[model samples]
Target: MTDTKNEQQWERTISFADGGTRLDKFWGRELADEGVSRGRVKAWIESGLAKVNGRVVDKGKYKLAAGEKTVIGAAEPEAGEGAPDPVRGRLDVLFEDAAMLMVCKPAGLTTHPAPGEPGPTLVNLLLHRWPDIAADKSGMDEQRPGIVHRLDKDTSGVMAVARTEAARLKLSADFAEHNVFKVYLALVHGVPTPAQGTVDAPMGRHPSQKTKMAVVDKGGREARSDYRVLWTGPRGLASLVAVRIHTGRTHQIRVHMAHIGHPLLGDAVYGPRESAEWERRPDLLAGLAPRQMLHAFYLSVFHPETGEPVTRWLPPPEDFCALLAGLPRECLRVGVVGMPGGGKSALMRFLGAMGRPCFSADECVAELYNPGGDGAAMINQRFGGAYTLEDGGVDKPGLFAAMRESDQVRREVNDMVHPMVRHRCEEFFKAHRDEPVAYAEVPLLLEGGWHKEGMVDLVAGVRCPADKRTGELRRLRNLPPEILAVFDSWQWPEKDKLAACDFVADNSAGLDHLEREAERLDAAALAALADRDRATEAWMDGLWPGLAGELDRERAGGEGPA
Candidate 1:
């Protein structure tokens, strides 16, 4: 597995003969020429900065397997002895004390000087502000004397600087023990579902791209990020998200966001460049900034000497705010409608796999009928215990028998359950307002007049051939022919449903064929969303022809738009 020739940086694919070797041992031998110590390799593994087969692995003793790949990002070489160059720049100092200071580092500023490369950096500005910071050599690098933790060069926000050696040492220890609280704001291309959630995937160096990072499954450390949707853009084109990270892995937020399929807008490295959205709207793409739309807007840490928690938050930069103002503001909601045995469940599953939030009416009904649920009691009250079983539960077979006896029984059950299901679906949509696209499978959507009620942005119909549908019902569900016929009669004609729906998915063929059709429909839905956003923008433009330009100029002039 060792590639001795390019010791400083190399990735290796493990063959069958190299299987079962410890990851650290394998990498340490491979990167021996880069002066990589076994201890350093172990540190990398424990820090979640090692990868195997494109996934993060936290254990150094993880045994390699055949056909697995590993990535090694060797540490930067130590700098030669030289006097640090001090450059002048503006620094937004948030807090100051004898022990330490907090400053808002802007995007595009390097934290410290690199070996042999002497240009303006945040460290230089620190030196210019507090000359004594150059003398406080508490950090590992002499060039970064008073620095503790550092953000990526392009990431901006609150950062702490130590003014004294004692303060630097104390702060460094606090960071090492994960005592700092870091919050970032990002503008991502799609809204994450559930409004708030956690990404607990481990992170490590990208297997092939030396400069990038990825979520790996071997030789990586634990990395977790908690994110909440603050706001979503028009038609779910973009979202403003707040993220709090528990572990300070390199590119953790970027990698995790991309892993969840909502990469930050303008993130050229992690975001997809050749996506349909980009291809359709090159003008919108051209408006994006060169850097990723990530801002470390908030931080909280213990005071170096006082032992008191200090928190600070800074608003996002002008460019970030301006970009958001120009984008659209509507969310996407889709309703899936189909008859029994028409593959509504399969369609919902496919949509969910594509990162859309999906809700099933059948699942909701099941929840209502579960043990000790209120639906059973309601049924007993309505039918005078005729449908109640010995276990005090609603006897489904008895209810079906009653339904077959009288159409009034079926209507009564629908009256009891349909409103509850609709209420649940409404709550679901409200909770997931930040999502780009949300889907709900309502089998009786057209029959119940939900589409006419304006509850969905678009309706999708799933169509299956008559013989195939009957065969599926007979083989898979053992549904009686009479019951199936009743269900079919309750639904609208297939041709009418297909004509009414925005898109139709044919499930008569195999699943692969159905999946292909679903993908095309998904793409079409996204395109429609984009079109709605554009229409909204055009309407706004018509209302105020130069409003957007004026706002951009105001932002550029350091004044936020009203």
Candidate 2:
């Protein structure tokens, strides 16, 4: 029926040859030799030990699709004793009153015991540490004892446990009435648009798969969750989001996030797979997350005995923080803007040599003007193909002539190309998110409003003196004097651009002088990035003082307790 690897555990992957068979029935027939009966299989399903296509399916009566892979991990010797042995370990006690206690639950520790499963769960440890909790008869099951609510085995966060029957009842009522508040920190695959919103949906057990939950229209209970994005990584690859749920349904955060197209990273069951941006970039996903990136970082509730408000919070576990560290941090984006011949490209080259990724708007435009490219297609559609070259490409000279002849034609081209150029620049930054700084050489950076659009973090203006401006233009492009004035007239004045920008490079000086300025700017940018990271850490520490000390001790090689 199943291959036994050891005396403690057994696992098997099976594919149904025929469709429409009940999952439990199929498992019962296959695992008969392993001494696993149909009833045991059902229990295991409810415990989320049975999976189909890597997703937990708790329903025994779920109809199977032909060739669907079903995997079952079963305990070798089924659980018989109702009471599990006390587990001796360290507990992260957050807050404790006479009525209730709050603690930080670590990942991989079950909140309670279940049939056919044997392990040192959170309850077992709690019982060992606080023997009085064992005497409290308030939980739904004897194994749970004072456990008022539960977190998934893989979710690490602050949890409340009742110390007495009165506390348990009050806390239960508070949870049922949606009085307790929970703030979860999750790292999701994509940045949710608008940064913050609410999800109001109905949730219920899957009609066929009894073990799994889904958003349903009929016979489902009301569920609501509010979320806001805290930070986004390069190219919107991942986001740190805060989630608050008014109602606790099974897998509510995971399911609701998947529904909104920004599934939590590393959540195999409900995470995005087919539509994931990092689907093809295994290197980027590697070391990103080992488990679902969800943590119950904060919880607030009324004291069961005194009716006083109590709040407790914990910083995310080491793994969760590690995952965040592995991701690319927000890189400093610097936009280089100036008149056509004001040495923007030279400055970009200097920065690029200094290990900063740089984007050239002219290069991007040239790439887009290739035959059959998006820019070429749009240009042809809008201009009746009159500016197209013999090779089905846009003739740059012809387009320039058109721009000079008519301001409307110039405006139309600018409207179309500026957006394309900006998008390309954005992708460049995303691709190099790991870098400390990046530069975009945009001739019309100010005119296009790239800085205000949140596309760039800072702007560097190239200022050239009036006498040297015409000489520089002659040396750079050898354009006619009239053409130079026209191009220069179109751009913001040197003083205005410099005033609006965070930094300015005097291009009137030679290459040596500009290089020195570039180096200074590089150091300043690096320091700014470090300051930002420190500020973020300070904010997190302020939010969770208890966890901050724990993290400090952990970093200092003090593994305080289990």
Per-residue lDDT tens digits of candidate 2, residues 443-538?
888887777878887888888777777886566777788887778777788778888898877777899988987887778778877887886666
Report the number of the highest-TM-score candidate: 2
TM-score of 1: 0.49
Assess each prediction's global lDDT (C-alpha) against the native. Answer: 0.74, 0.74
lDDT of 1 by residue, 295-327 (tens): 887777788788877666677777876676556
Model 1 ranges off by over 4 Å = 1-81, 115-118, 136-140, 274-285, 329-562
Worst 10 residues of 2 by lDDT: 1-10
Candidate 2 vs. truth: CA RMSD? 10.7
